[model samples]
Target: MDKKKRVIFLVDMESFYASVEIASNPELVGKPVVVCGDPEKRHGITLAANPLAKKAGVKTAMPLWEVKSVCPQAQFVRPHMGKYIEASLQITEILYEFTDQVEPFSIDEQFMDVTASQSLFGSPQHMAKMIQKRIWDEVGVRARVGIGENKIQAKMACDRFAKKNLEGIFELNSTNYMKKTASLAVDELFGVGSRMKRNLYKIGIYTIGDLAKRPLEEMKKRWGVNGHILWLSAHGIDYSPVKNDSTELQKGVGNSITLPRDYIYKEDIQVVLLELADEVCRRVRALHKRGRTISLSFRGADFNHPTGFHRQTTIPFATSDTIEVYQASLQLLEHFWDRQPVRSIGLSLDQLEDDREIQLDLFSHPIKKLQLGKTMDEIRERYGKTAIFRASSLLSSGLLFDRATKIGGHEA
Candidate 1:
């Protein structure tokens, strides 16, 4: 919170996916819009809702059918993640115009250190307004800005206070930090989750002020090192540096979809698995990476004992081949399925490793298969994703066409 420390700014794009949808199609402006998954395929969870939809009680992660019930007049649009990512990248470029210390927190949020650049661009508030204006003018999206001495304070202030104000800027510093945040709930702090919150309440620490004032020894006794960190954060103390790089190495790649109706037939589920594996493999190849393990998870339609099954299988070699991942997932599905009607299906690739290492076998090397996968990737990337498709995808139950141009089960 000291003025001498580096200044941090947390910028958040407002209703990002929905906003991008609106910007792309100006006719959607001023309408209550909710960006969701592909409705035709029965993947209909709300991913993001615009302000008008939010005011009508539509919420993110709510079922699309439920959203209609809450706000019948709301327009449902499929998400375009590719477009959103492009806009985010443009915004990142704009931020770098001001400072080199820009760390992208997510697709819609960034942390920027303008300490060294403040002299070049007036005060932090001025820089925040300039960035907000530039994003609006150039990218057709609005951003909220939070200014503080460190990342934690800037992020918390942005989420908790900045978005609600007209100026869309909030500053938290050592002088007025406690006074401004004393009445806030303990869980409202950035890093505190539900479990930690319950523990805090059990110890009579119900507010940020209470956590800030707790004895260090008592906190350490309760939560060890994390407890000490929590106390410091509660007092508006954070020293983490904002890295300049924006590229985040993906830890894994996967996809999941909720069926339009209960999938009663195993073959129908197999078709869906193939489609998901196609998308997942495409992503793995896009990153030039592969994994040794494939995981399959599904949710049942039964309400009585709604718990579903999840299982993983490890293969001998890493692969980004669609059929290989699908075969592995198929075997795990047969082993774990309870024969109950399935309402949802998910596939994930983990135990990730670089694609550079290829193990040789006596019978034949997998070099040919790898080349084939790479060739398919190149073809797909050159044209559209739907330009090339597996013959199995044209089957009666396949969702390949429905999902090819989509991201996270929504339209791209």
Candidate 2:
């Protein structure tokens, strides 16, 4: 017997943060609402905007000042990431009622594989309507769903079609996806960003059809594995599965902060770097992972040009020691920083491995440092993050205390 076609649905929340705010308050039901970061702290970028705000030309990541200029009557609300997370979990639980193959793509998006569940739930479109209705009834949030034969098709179907449709549902399969999307711009295909579009344009590919017609080997020769993946996505061919378990290994661990103001002095920058290093290493230790590469990144205070540098170095040994990571980051900053005023700083640890075995060094006390880190982690876990911190965090430039109160760099 021939294999049965897969049925995948990508459910995306509409203006998630702003919608949550409106749902909880109720007073702002018909008003144009924008959810943003704290303007007083210079984190005033728009995180989400409701439909009315969007109609007034407000967009995600737009500056709050710009949003006000565009929609003067718009009501602003600070993001409640905790509340959003709760809603996301509730939606995930609702999805489980329909299928066990649900995978969360982001806090605002989830993918459901209903190949086997279609018999139980009826057609894919009917299942999508039921899921959308359940989410709206239970969570008071609006959702759009895209159905396809695979993940890539579902993602594009939702992002490019469903969200724009009044019915809030779309289906793109092997037979119809090309007919609908072929003449569209190359960048309209899933995963094709601006740079890739420019590259494709240089090679006489301007539409999805152009890319699909090109020989796969030529694309592979031009861009290697990424080229092949792009060709596959252009043809709506994705073999990836929707797995629920999170057995995937983390690629990196990092933290970044936008300073309340431009920091010019080396001492001030170092203070922030140390705080970031500590946070990153602490997370790595919690994962029981060690990394050999440390990366330092910064952005200049000039918003117009947005200039700075990102540099990384690999050491012989993998260790999650805060001081060691700090030292490496400090070196990178000293060597690369152009003495420019920095608006933001970031640090990350990658090239990871399980911390099952410790590498011995005659000059360094690795075991002792590891034990000390574990103890500090335990103390923080028991008493709270602010219970113990480096003395440097007491300095005026340090953001440890401020950061501890925030989740994903915003108020909790």
Give per-residue lDDT, candidate 1, residue 79.
Answer: 72
Q: What TM-score, computed on C-alpha atoms, does each candidate reach?
A: 0.80, 0.91
Model 1 spans > 4 angstroms off: 1-4, 24-28, 37-39, 174-183, 191-240, 291-295, 302-306, 309-336, 350-371, 386-391
Model 1 C-alpha lDDT per residue in residues 1-412, reported as the tens digit of each score: 2457888999999999889889888889999999887666566678899999999999888888899899998888877778988999999999999998889988999999999987899988999999999999999998999998899889888988999898899999877889988899999998899999998898899999998888888888888999889988888988888987432446678799877788988899999998889888877876767888899999987545786898899999888888889999999988989888998899999877777787775554567777887788789889977788888778877777766766676566
lDDT of 1: 0.86
Error of 2 at 68 (Å): 1.4
Clashes of each: 0, 0
Candidate 2: the clashing residue pairs are: none
- The per-residue C-alpha lDDT of model 1 at residue 210 equals 92
Worst 10 residues of 1 by lDDT: 243-252
Which whole-number lDDT from 0 to 100 does residue 89 have in model 2?
94
